[model samples]
Target: MKPVEIAKGVYDVGVIDWNIRDFHGYSTHLGTSYNAFLIVDEKIALIDTVKKGFAEQLLRNISTIIDPGKIDMVISNHTEMDHSGSLPYIMDKIGIQKPLYCSKMGEKNLSRHFSSDLNYQVLKEGDEISLGSKTLTFIETRMLHWPDSMFTYLKEDKILFSSDAFGQHYAGHEEFDDVVGNKIMFHAQKYYANILLLYAPLILKLVEKITKAGLEFNIICPDHGVLWRNPGRIIEAYAKWSKQEDCADKAVIVYDTMWDSTHQMALAVADGLHENGIDVRPMKLRDWDRSDIMTEVLDAKAVIIGSPTLNNGIFPTIADFITYMKGLKPKNKIGAAFGSFGWSGESVKIIEQNLGEMNFDLPVSGLKIPFVPDNNGLEKCREFGSQLAKAIKG
Candidate 1:
């Protein structure tokens, strides 16, 4: 990706990872971009760097506008390797003697990542640095996702350089929110569902703090995906998502079947949910990615999981999905568990326990069937779904 000027002298000097389909464990069907910005004032500053492998691309992008050595300061917004992986390389290419600015925790984190000693200037919330005409304000956003996370605000430009907040794992030609249109929010929602869901409370507090601070932003540029030209769109989204409210009267049935028994139960559950005037989605574990399923769970009022027991335990796929969902910590959900077992029918019990740990309102004990579910067992599953739907409506 070429360096595109987002503001008067602020350029997006970042690299696109169009082929990266997986980020950690999150599925990135649309890939992603490691966005870094270069602010050219009387004193040039580079805010964050790309991934390690994309160091050359970052350098080339910076070279398009000015010499790497000309950058007076380097700001490390987040010490996560994705954003700071190329920091050492960049500091080496430019002069290592140049002042490196970061949050207090960012200094410690980045120091551990690189062995070399360099200039480290630690800043905290309410700190401001001058670059001739423009002033850079730092807001310490610790634990939005990481301890070292923070945001840099270009006071002159009214652009908030949000390190990882409001970022999406999407790779596209468009660099601005207006250019990308509606598709941008899909990726943003998925990102918030998977990566930032656990940090929702902190996000809410942070957004409130930003509002209380009266920090108005014209543009919000994150360390990934496209920049938000309409900054409020994502801020409003963050506010809504963080509240853990506004769920639909919908249910999501996630299941995995060794035989057809659990599959039949899932279908019956979906049918019962639909019969009760609830929007239901039955997702086969083998067919749906865990991240995608978590995204569905984000706004759904109920999550019903089914699994065929395997060796006295829940199916591995079900275990995988439950573990993944447990970490994301989606709130305001009701849940039910269903399963079929040949000998030991512990799958439903275990699923119930996991969902309970996530604070899902489980009104009924799980339904377990022995061997392949007969018509009677399938009917039980349908009853369970109807009961869950009634609980959701109430």
Candidate 2:
């Protein structure tokens, strides 16, 4: 696809990889792109670069418009190899002594990956760099996804160079969010649920900081996805997402079973929840995706976890799910656990232990069916559902 002029002097030179099926082992079922931007002010600047293997193509794309040597500033928004891996080669090819810019943490990461001698000009929070015609202002957004993360704003254009925040793994030549439509929202949720969910508090702080800074951004150029022309839409949406608040009247029940006994118990619980006018999505851990469940939990008010005992422990898949949830820190929700065990009957306790370690304020209600779940045990599962619903409602 031809590189398109996204706005005046702002070009979307990032490539579309329809052939790519996965990104860093995360299944990008809808494909993705590495978004890079070029800003032409008095001193031309390349905000970020692309992958190392695509160095040749990246240069060729830049060559079509302007002399690579004339690029006066290079900003490394993220030190993730995907974004900054080509910096060494790009600098060598252009014979550029122009300073590479990033946070101090980003500089450390760059040194580790490339070499100690790789020249970098580090900026702290609220630092500014003059581009002759326009000024680039920095805002340190630590742990939005990485400690080294940051955003740059062009004073003249009101454009925010957000590295990963508001980014998606969507691959397309379309430069605008309105053009991308539903895919933008879908991939945004996928990206947020998997990557930025845990840092919701930081994100909320960032929103407040940006507003308090009075940075009027009309354009948003993110690192890995489409640029935003309608800045308010994204900003308003971010305001809600960063609050760790649910957006739905639904619940997600994630369970893993052995020998169909625990599975039966899960189904009984789901039936009872549905009977109580709750929208229940009962998922089996065998093929349930952690990221998918994360997206579900992002909007869910209640959650139910289940696993069958395996060697006096919770099932491995269930364990992995809890680990992911804990890392993502899905807050502002009520949750509980259930399982079936033969001997030790420790699966529920283990699940509770994991939840407690994550500092989740889970209401005290967990269940474990002894041996096999019979009709009587099914009643217990239904009762657990009732307790969970009551907690969620309260």
* Clash pairs for candidate 1: none
Q: What does candidate 2's lDDT look like per residue over 353-381, in tens digits? A: 87777666688568888878888889888
Clashing pairs for model 2 are none
lDDT of model number 2: 0.80
TM-scores, all candidates, are 0.97, 0.92
lDDT of each: 0.90, 0.80
Return the top candidate by lDDT: 1
TM-score of structure candidate 2: 0.92
Those runs of model 1 whose alpha carbons end farther than 4 Å from true positions after fitting are none
